[model samples]
Target: MSANASANSFQALVRLLRYARGYRRRIVAATTCSVINKIFDIAPEILIGVAIDVVVNQEHSFVARIGFTTPQEQIVVLAVLTFFIWAGESIFEYLYKILWRNLAQRLQADMRLDTYEHAQRLDMAYFESKSSGQLVATMNDDVNQLERFLDGGANSLIQVGVTVVAVGAVFFVISPLIALLAFTPIPLIIWGAFFFQRKAGPLYADVREKVGDLASRLSNNLSGIATIKSFTSEAREAERLRSVSEAYVEANRRAIQVSSAFIPVIRMAILAGFLATFTVGGMLALRGDLNVGAYGVLVFLTQRLLWPLTGLAEVIDLFERAMASTRRILDLLAVPVTVKDNEGKPLAEPVRGEVSFDAVSFRYAASGVGVESVSLHVPAGNTLALVGATGSGKSTLMKLLLRFYDPQAGRVCIDGQPIGEVSLASLRQAIGLVSQDVYLFEGSIRDNIAYGRPEASEAEVIEAARTAEAWEFIQALPQGLDTAVGERGVRLSGGQRQRLSLARALLKDPPILVLDEATSAVDNETEAAIQRSLAKIGHGRTVIMIAHRLSTIVHADEIVVIDGGRVAEQGTHAGLLEKGGRYAAQWRVQTGAMEESEALG
Candidate 1:
């Protein structure tokens, strides 16, 4: 590898080790087994040399010097020793496999879970900038890449190191000249491995990126399948997916070309080392300069030493891929959380739900379209409605209150306490939000309703569903509340999904409830049902509603008309109508349009 890239891979590995510090004891245990297993594995080669000595030297054998005088006795001794060596190898081999594989499973699961939790805590802006498929790829694919390396590659590397060191020591003690010549090609092999590593490093990284892109394309397509079918763009989407898939394949092909050449290069280098030991060691034994048993040891050990080096190509390939994945995974873990929870105090008990947006201003980093110095307040038990055209920053105000994106200027408070000074858990728990884009999990209606309060009783879930005017339709289904919602509630109608979302929020029973276009998806009858429910539901809790439909908020205690991220007007429904401004203009258009439809009917 180039010094710079090698250093980066090394740094990435170091970072991974630091992150895995919790598993240090398990790592040490696994590595100890690997090293001990290699020792026992190499012992059999030594035993073969000793058995050769017993056959040729008899009484003059090395074992005879150690007090076993007969060749038969020494042979039996070697047989028994071989059995134990092989047994030890088997035992430790099993041990290390269990240790390393279990470690990989546990570490990968923990890393994925930790990464997901951290991602959840990140600000909404971060999610807006990233694709869901890319995040899933990192959490699943990249983490699995690391697990595959740990499962086998790590043990291979450790055993290779042991083979080189243990065999090299034996070679030097037997005949330094043979050892020098036999070891000559090792430097070349090492250099070539690193050289290919440098080339493969960047290519593997590109392969990973291309895989992420492919994942993103797939995720986007699957999620929008209905849209593609409706628009008859299935063929176009298939072509797009094919393009991304081809890009991933091409990247893999490039990486394979470089990694595949390493094995052949290493094999030639190993050949040089093997031939040197064979020729020179045979010459030495013929000249009586080397003991026969030791010379035999050198011949066998030469292959044992150099053959493992050839496998370095595969090990290095695995290492490079792992390091690439590690860098991406750790880089995600290192992303600074801009919206930190400061571990601040919780909100006061019996949260009165008095909410205020004090001169709040926020601009989207990419679009620069957000609220501009907007401010408003809603007293406890009061309903305040936000009216605006689409993209007029109505929902941005609600997001600020929820701390999804902190305002660039000013503060949002509940119960006269600034939200930024409170713990995120406490602040969020105080409010329940049902957004314009309703989302339902792929589960039963009851499960979705009780999601925010899973411990809630069945009676409680039923009441929340009833309050959202969803219980009637839910009862009509064959499975009733147990009916599957399907993925993102695709099985349900838009209005049904909307009601379920409202039911979920109501189940939470937060002190403050925020509904952003909660009834936008419903038919007129369902809308009237929800309106009547809201009249009763708002009796004890604060309600903040953002609506495009003027009729929905006609009875709100106060209505604030937002225009271009600023408050254009604010008053009670009757008062705003008398002012004949923005609110009045919007009301007339909506009501007049409704009246014409009624007359036509």
Candidate 2:
């Protein structure tokens, strides 16, 4: 397992490069420009050497052999060459910079979208076990960090590689003895880089993990700010967040402390090469074994070769950070989707909403809280209400029917076909869900209602709002349907949010509708209003209602009373009241003229 984990970490960047294969041509073009630019950038030192040769050698200089007889003409020709070289270098620099940065932006955007699409495909239980903030970090923060590296560090790496190779060639051609001394420090510098890489790899991965935890904490605090304010727990929440942020800072500090020491140590090693080139090349020139101009080139080129190694610290740091983030992003992509549609079976054509639970059972992996040995059926175009005290698994049963969590035992089928064998898209499309916890995106009211059907016409949106009994309240808002609803519909009252949630579901116009405690949080008047709306649209669609209020479901075609994850009674409300069982006891208490007793016997 340890070996496998090590292999996985090492392959993170390799996998990213494989992903880049789609844009290989762009990368190649950008990299070619970078290489050509560096070559021209290195030419200035050689130009200086040729200029030195023209001055010292005078008429018999290397320039004279190229047909320039006088020093003045040679100088002019040299200046022209210099102008074009610098221009060519600047041109390629511009091209590479633009190409690389734009490529980063495009790739980052695409990767984020693909990652989110994959996240949506995952089973509901996976999301339950994960935090939204951590997912956001993976999709946003980590991806942004990689884009930053691409914007600058990518060029630094390519140019530095070019400098090393080009400069080393010049050093050797001048004098092997001087070249050997100049080349001595390079191997040590490379070895140090690899050593730093080994140590910093795990530290950076931990840094990424720490930031994810911090993001999760921040997200939790922001979402619950209202609750925190009401409870006056600002100080406590802030301290909790401080503790998480401090941990993140400490993790980064450790990684920074290690990577920080890299530059100074590399500089010490670089001193060896620079001084040796300066001293040895001078001696070779004085001994008449090498020309003064060649010696000048060697001295200048040696610093060019070695000084950039100081920036090796930064490039290595960027590489490590990118690799760490890549692993996280890839790990999310690597997660096997446990729940998926089976091939060869589509939702039966002309889906009629006949949902059945044939002795189905399931339990939460973390809490072991779920329904067990439950069996019920909602026939086409009928209403079935589920009622029980809280935590009685009523909602869990509905989740199972929706295939949010498949039952561990038995089968859940729609229209006599197992849902697992049906295409997930078609099956889910045929069902519309509206729960008590209504979530609205930060957009106009019309957008929220048409979320499931983006192509829904404006008239259709208003019609659905009217059917949901939300049109009157919506018209009172300043912008009507165009009014922006704040995040999670925080700008709207509880009833308004619930009504909009209903409108969203109604707009889907599905054959099956599941209202899981949809009206539980609303006032009596709003609940009545929603009830009237439900009654109107309840026909022509199979409705599964989970409600705490007995009055709402009293007219249901059937009522199922759940107790401890199992059905204790299943009958019409009138029949259950006549039998004087658990449902009857609850009904009596809710309608009692005396002091309230137990809620559900």
Candidate 3:
């Protein structure tokens, strides 16, 4: 390998070893078993020579020198030794397999979980810029690839090293000349492995990238399956997916083509060592210069030592694939968490519900759309509504309050303390958010409702559901609260999902509630019921509501009208209507649309 490539490999290995640190004891034990197994595994060749010596030398065999006097007794002694050797080999083989496989499973699981947790702690911008499918591929597919190598490749490599040492030591004890000849191919094989690794490193890295891209394509297509069907573009999507798959296949093909040439070339090198040992050792026996049994041992040991090197090519193949995957997995874990809680500050206690935006401003680094130089306040236990057109600052203001993104300018304060100075958990715990885009996991209805507060009692959960006006429909289902919501709550209608989300927030029951178009999906009647529920429980809590449907916020205690990222108007709903400005124009258009529809009907 080139120095640069070697350095990269070493760095990757060090990082991986850090993950394996906790399993060090098991690793040592497993490694000891592997070495012991390979030692005995190579002893069978030496045993073959012993059997031959017992036949040729009879009472004068090496066993006689050790203790036995009769050939029959020596043969019996050899049998017992052989039995133990094979038994030891078999026992350690079982141990290493169990140890290595279990290690792979545990390590992979831990790596996946850490990567996912770190990903969650990253800022919103990172996720917005990256592909979800690629992230999923890293957490699932790439980690699995690394696990596959740890399953067998790791053991094979250790055994190969043991074979070289054990067999070479035996050969040198008999004849240094034969040992030199038998070991001639070792350097070539080692060089071939390094050569293949350096060449295959980037190829497999590209292969990993290609596979991740393919996964991204598939994820996107599946997520947009509804849109694809509505547009009748299945063939187009199929073509795009096929193109992505072809890129992956071609990348793998390049890696395979290079790796496939490895074993055969190394096999030829192995054959040269085997031939030299067979011819030279046979000649030594003919001249009576070496014992026949010794010659036999040399011949057998030579092949055992060098032929396994051919499989080294396969081991290197697995190692390279694993290293590629390891880098990706490590890269994910290495992502800096820019959105974490301030370590210098602790979460606030006894939150009062008052909120303020003191000249707050924020602009998305990527999208360039955010609230700008805006200021507002809602007193403790008062409802405030923010109304604006799309691309205005309504949602951006809420995001700042939630700390999903920190503002570029100004401070958002809750009950006099700047939120940025409070612990993120404390700030989030103080507020409940029910957004327009409701998401429910693949679980029963009760599970999604109690998501925010999993330890809530069944009665408390039911009461929250009733508060969101979702209890009636949930009861109509055959399983009631236990009914499955399906993927992203696709089993329920939009309004039903929104109500469940409201129930989730209601269950949280924080001091402050932010409802951003939370009732958009529900009909007027259900919306009214939810508003009534909100009105009842919302009395004691500060409410920050964002709605494009201005009617929902008409009853809010204070209404702030935003236009072009600035506050255009602020008053009670009646006061804004009396001003006859933008708010009046929006109210006229919406109410007129409703009236015309009713008249036509």
Which predicted model would earn the best TM-score?
1
Q: Write the residue-wise lDDT of candidate 2 on 1-601 in tens digits.
A: 4344345556987898887789899889989999999999999999899899899997988899989999999999999999999999999999999999999999899889988999998889889999999999999999988888888888999999999999888877778898899989999999887777777788888899988999999999999999999999999999999999999999999989888999999998999998998997888788988888898888888888999998989997898898889889988988888777676667888988999999989999998888889999889999999999898999998888777877899999999999988878888888899998999999999999999998999999999999999999999999999999999988999999999999999999999999999988999888988999998899889999999888889989999999999999999988999999999999887778333444444
Give the higher-TM-score candidate: 1 or 2: 1
lDDT of 1 at 550: 88
Predictions in order: lDDT: 0.91, 0.90, 0.89
Query: Please, what is the TM-score per model?
Result: 0.98, 0.94, 0.95
Model 2 misplacement above 4 A: 1-9, 66-69, 342-346, 593-601
Tens-digit lDDT track of model 1 for 440-475: 988999999999999999999999999988899999
**Which one wins by lDDT: 1 or 3?**
1
Model 3, position 391: C-alpha lDDT score? 83
For model 3, residues 473-544, the per-residue Cα lDDT tens digits are 999999999999998998998889988998999999999999998877778887887788888888889999
Summed backbone clashes in each candidate are 1, 0, 0
C-alpha lDDT of residue 140 in model 2: 95
